[model samples]
Each structure stands twice: as C-alpha cells, then as structure tokens.
Target: MKKLVISIVLVNLLAACASQKPHETTAAPAAPVAAAATATAPATATVAAAKTAVDPLNDPTSILAGRSVYYPFDVAAVQDADKPLVQAHAEYLSKNAARNVRLEGNCDERGSNEYNLALGQRRADGVMKMLELGGAKAAQLDSVSYGEEKPKATGHEESSWSQNRRTDLNYAK
Candidate 1:
C-alpha cells in the first residue's frame, strides 16, 4: 500500500514537471497523458506544429505586392496614388532587415538618352528617399536607372508610355 501511494506521488510530480516547463514554440491542445511513456521524450513533434508566418510580399492580397510605382511623362516625383504602395514596401523592408530591394527606374521613349537616364535616376532616388523616411534602412535599398532600356510596353501610345514610366521594387532572393 505504501509503494502504491509513492508511485502515484511520483507520477503526479512527473506530470507537474512536464506541465510547468517552458516551450520554445507554442504547443497545441494537450492530450490526456495517460501514462509515463512520454515524460522523458523531447517535444519535437509538438514544436513542428507551431504556426509559421507567411511573408506579406508573397501574399497577393497585400499592398506590398504592388511593386511598381508609375509616373507621368517626364515626371520624377512619386504620385499620390502610389504613396500607399511605397509606404507598405517601406514598412516591410524596415521590419525585415535580412531582405533587400533594388529600385529600378524606367522611362518612356520621348526623351534623349542622357535626359532619360538622369530623370530615371531621380525617379529611383525619390522612391528610395520615401522608403528611408518610412523606416527602412538605407543599407537594404539600392537605386538604379534603366532609362528607356527596359520598357514594360513597346508601343508609342500614351497607354504604353504610361506603363513604361515607373520604378520597380525588385526583392533580392
């Protein structure tokens, strides 16, 4: 009878110890632990079930997925319409220090090569400034001008030109 009581006390102590210990990852709803079989085992299986976060950039519904900021003809400033897009990217970059982005500036086919290149640089730089102001580190950003070299649309119409004048936020792998 004494041996039976001691065994029960030992089992209660073991269960208490298991329940009180901290978990590195969140544990799921615990099952009724009927026996002492799992007392000494590491909880790797439970850790594997811990929830993981999906990156906002990869989530199509997030504003961070809107990578391109468009501009009017010969304009270098970011438009009011695209401010939210830039702000979201800026916030994401600020949070994820390991991530880096290249701001690629592109222009329409209406300007001289030198002029277009300079304008594109200004456009890229403008977005870079906004990102920095919004809390992203300068080290996580790079700006470059492609000028008219990388056109999103090849046609000479306003529709095509509108598509071409922009800066693209390209994330590094």
Candidate 2:
C-alpha cells in the first residue's frame, strides 16, 4: 500500500510539470551594468552624433571658406575689406596648433619679372606679418611669391590687374 501511494505522488508531480508552459519558467533579473548601459544608450548616441559634425574649415557656411585676399596694385597692405578675412584665418590657425599654412603672393602681368617677384614677396610677407600679429604662431606660417607667373586674369585691363594682385592662403595637407 505504501509503495503504491509513493508512485501515485510521483506521477502527479510529473503530470503537473509537463502541463506547465515553457514561458512560465522564472528568469534572473538583468545585471546592473547591462541596465545602466541600456539607460544611457540614447545619451551616448547623441554625444557621438555631435562629435561627428563637420569641422568649420570644411564647412561651406564658415567665413574661413575665403582663401584669396585681394590687394591694390603695388600695395602690400591688407585692404580694409579683407582684414576680417585675415583675422578669421589667424583665429583658425591659433586654435589649431597642428595646422600650417602657406601664403602665395601674386602680381599682375604689367611689371618686369624681377620687379613682380619682389613685389609679390612683399605682399606675401605683409600678410604673414599680419597673421602673426593676430595670434598665429610664426612657425605655422610661410610666404612664397608666384609673381606674374600665376596671374588669375590674362587681360591687360584694371579688372584683371585687380584680380591678380592677391595673396592665396593654402593649408598644408
């Protein structure tokens, strides 16, 4: 009789377990580290998105987009209209210490090659000095004269001359 009763109890327990659904099994709670990471996922994504934004140098909307600073004929001075351009470049250079620039000075087709070369050198040097004074490091700036060899305009008129007398700011690769 005692053996029959034990067999009946074991059968009942087995039947109960077999009838339960698989999803009824209890699960351990999530880990603290995993919970924290899940909570902050959106904030982390936001920070990464902000960092991926474009740099001002490559941005089309920035004032630093202007590369050429035009000057009057035979003048080495930065014109009133172009001063802000130079200032913007200087600010950029100062903020980015690893960046370096080359100032290429050019002249119109009117002058002799020798005279044009010298004038171009003066123009490049003038811009270089201004950048240095505006907070750029001396080591970050270099000046070169292309003179009449690299004229922007080929005409003999004042319009072309005005376009050619300029300093081009080139960033190092």
Candidate 3:
C-alpha cells in the first residue's frame, strides 16, 4: 500500500512539473526529507484548491464545470445523476451573487416543433426550480426553450438524441 501511494504521488508530481513551461532556474533542488515534505503537503494542496475555487466554472475538474443536465428520452425532469451538477451550480451562483445564468431547454427531433418547444420549456423550468431550491435566487435565473433548434450532436441516433435531450446552463457574461 505504501509503495502504491508513493508511486501515485511520484506520478502526479512528475505530471505537474511536466505541465509547466520551461524556465531558467539556478536554485538547487530541495533535499528529500519525507517527514518535512509530508508536513508541507497540506499547505500546498490548500493553495492549489484556493486557486481553483477562484473560478470553478472554468475549472474542468470542478463539478460546476458541467454545464448541461441530460434527461432520458422525452423526460423533462433532471435525473439523479444530474442533481449533483445542479447543486454545484446552485452553490456557485449563490456565492457569486453577480453571476446569472440562462436555462436553455432542448429536445430530440422526434417530437413536433410545438411539442418539442413545450417539452424543452418543461425541462428548463425543472432545472430552474432545482437550482432555486438548492440555493440560487430566482432573479439570477432565466429559462428559455430552444426546443430542437440547437443540438450538441447532429447524428440521428440514440447518441445524438441523448445529447439533444438536455438543459444547458448558459452563464451571462
């Protein structure tokens, strides 16, 4: 277990170093001291976390980064899997009072234009309600139905349809 943990930590440190741009440096490498290194690890981790929290919406690893909530075929309600995403956005929005979002509801091509529009509205409204309940204020949210007009996927299959049946969280600039 210790070897496995050490190997994972080594891989992560190497990856972090590799991701940085090259820079001129004359400083000597810090000496390896396991106890001292472990003691400072939490401080480094806290700083990294604080940096990400500054703008979690743009952080791909953050739960708030998920901008769309998908539903099963013809379903207007948010699935259990999407609840966490919605809650994350709600918390983020609540904390950042100035940030506003639009709930764009969409649907697959199987339904008539009117039916799709209505369904899309239902989907968007459902997400809006959940966001409000989770902590976001109603004033920060606007609901709109794009119906089948815009699609994340263009193929005519379950893969595409699944993508279309979603409510997108569009943040205002």
- Residue 18, model 3: lDDT of 36
Candidate 2 residue spans exceeding 4 A from truth: 1-52
What is the lDDT for 147 in model 3?
92
lDDT of 3 by residue, 1-173 (tens): 97787668656644553343121111111121233335545788775666576576775545665688877668998876577678778877887799999999999898898899999999999999999998999999999999998887997755577678889999998
Which residues of candidate 3, in runs, are more than 4 Å off? 1-53
TM-scores for all candidates: the values are 0.70, 0.69, 0.70
Where model 1 places Cα greater than 4 Å from the true spot, the runs are: 1-53
RMSD vs true structure, all candidates: 25.5, 32.8, 15.3
Return the lDDT, model 1, position 161: 75
Best by lDDT: 3
Over 1-173, each residue of candidate 2 has an lDDT whose tens digit, in order, gives: 97787558646644553343121211111132244335546788764664368555675545576787776668888876667668778877997789899999999887798899999999999899999999999999999999999888997656567679889999998
Lowest summed lDDT across 10 adjacent residues in model 3 is found at 21-30
Arrange candidates by lDDT, descending: 3, 1, 2
Better of 2 and 3 by lDDT: 3
- Model 2 quality (TM-score): 0.69
* Model 3: lDDT to the true structure: 0.76
Report lDDT per candidate: 0.75, 0.75, 0.76
